[model samples]
Target: MGSTKHDGDVIILTGASSGIGEVTAWELAKRGYRLVLAARRADDLGQLAGAITQRGGLALPVPTDICVEAQLERLVQMTLDHFGRIDVLINNAGVAKAQDAATPTNPHIDMILGTNLIAPMRLTRAVLSHMIPRRSGHIVNVGSVASYISAPGQAVYNASKHGMRAWNDTLRREMKPLGIKVSLVSPGFIRTPMTETVRGMPMVGPETVARIIAKVITHPQREVITPMAYKFLIALTTAFPGPSDAVMSAWRVWKW
Candidate 1:
């Protein structure tokens, strides 16, 4: 028999307090998926979790700081304890900011890379056992278009995302035969608190990314570059490296 189907299937969403994570949780709740919501703010997570349950959905709020390994381990354990299985893990928490070009300061580089890259890697490792045993699961890593393009002031951010993209690609290959699905969603710029602190950039609303993410989980693929235009851009970039660099350079005139 197939697994129990409900509008309340358990899905653990990191960075659930705001932005893409927030909207994705709401979308999942609408589709009847119970949520294990995580973020640094307990109040925010609690509020979202409560709203979800009040609307006839289910949620377990686990306030988390993904940068810590122990915290991520506990997160996985708690989800397993409550739901018996983790249906999906969305590695959605990350930080990004362009370092000033002239100064080139990187005082917080480790924090950026740790939270954006390492923590998700650790979280994914924590959940793999049950997923591999059951021979089923989905891992969605949120990447950025910057992963494919190299920009001057955004080097660190790109490197972190690039690492994630590469990991997603390799993980898909390693887990395919075991019936696991791994995917990466690289968005250009989503209008969120994370992006709002900066100024003058192309932006898509969080709901837009959330809708695409909801679809991606059920039907898995390698990687997605949203809006269809990115597919063409990536293809074009491959054939002419110098021009691609120029395009990336132009985008940074404002970013820097």
Candidate 2:
């Protein structure tokens, strides 16, 4: 039922210019999703949209900076104006800085929290008014394995992801009664521009993560952690917090 319904579904995807979001747009387009691509890079967004359209998929590029309140509001409004109804909202825009919290720059903290956590929450709120009335919608949050496994030098990044995970979990339970599906995709290391300096990690390609995200939208689930191996790691860390902390602490690559 869910799968069939997702065909030709109207979706708004943030951070659609590159990385996981860009690949996810391609994956969803192939699966028959009509996309509204949002990102700060207008040129990249336009090219991606044009390519999707050339392939007989529907897409519109709306340049957006999710951290800005006005931009986010306009993004939701534009989606509603263009598509009339939005079936899914892919909250994929995020930023990460591998630095210690001890430095404590206001702009850095704001950028991380605003883009990764606050923007998604605000966008979801803006979209929910329309979705709740219709009794149908899906919110798919692209999170990180860092949501579960805390790493050094990623204090702000970890906090944002952990908040995203909590929000997704709570929204899933709340929206169940409203007939809305909330899903979270927590991927481990993925090869992207943001992770270019991260070497020798167990990384999956963006396309793989995108495919999983597409599947999650069609067949809704509460959460999914990519690469599968991370699932066991999550369990191990959860059951033995002290040893897990010790291991992560000793891992020099993850240190600042």
Candidate 3:
């Protein structure tokens, strides 16, 4: 059944306190999906949940640190206990510790890899068993343009996203026969707290991404690149890595 057949299509969204995740929650809630919001900030999660509830929807805030395996386990258990089954898992929680790779300590590496890569793997594993038996579910992995185009000061972040895309691709093929759909939503830079310091770059708003994500949930696809323009950029960069690298190198030195 399509996601629109929602009287209680339970969805668990991570990184839901702000940015794309936040807006996506509103979009899905308005469409009748029951939400289980997870994030590190309890106050923000509660506020967003309250706002959704005020809008005459079902949203339960489960303040969670996705980096913590125990917390992630608790989150899935809570959602299942409350909603009975998870129709969708939106792995939106991600972190970017952009700096020169040489200076990264173990903690920095762990933090980036843990939140951006390991967390999703674990969360997906937790929900896989549930979705597999039913043989019907969706997993949306939110990635970035960096997954295709690499640049300076984003070595770890780039690695994490590339890893996400790899996992999403493999899982997509593996789960196709089981009726499980996996989608990777890769977007160019978005105007969010995470990218506030990135000036002079074209950035789409979070809602733009949320809309694409909402559409993908209903009409599932293997992958989606928002704004449609990034698809060309990604194609060019992938086809001509040498020239792409040179151009990106020059971009790092360009004066704003």
- In angstroms, give how far residue 35 of model 2 lies from its true place: 0.4
Q: Which regions in candidate 3 have their CA more than 4 angstroms from the true location?
A: 1-3, 253-256
lDDT by residue for model 3 (169-225), tens: 999999999999999999888888888777687878999999888889888988888
Extract clashing residue pairs from model 3: none
Per-residue lDDT, model 2, residue 117, is 97
The residue pairs in collision within model 2 are none
RMSD values, in order shown:
3.1, 2.3, 2.5
lDDT of each: 0.82, 0.89, 0.89
Pairwise TM-score winner, candidates 1 and 3: 3
Question: In candidate 3, how many Å is residue 148 off?
Answer: 0.6
lDDT of 1 at 175: 90
TM-score of each: 0.90, 0.95, 0.95
Q: Name the lDDT of candidate 3.
A: 0.89
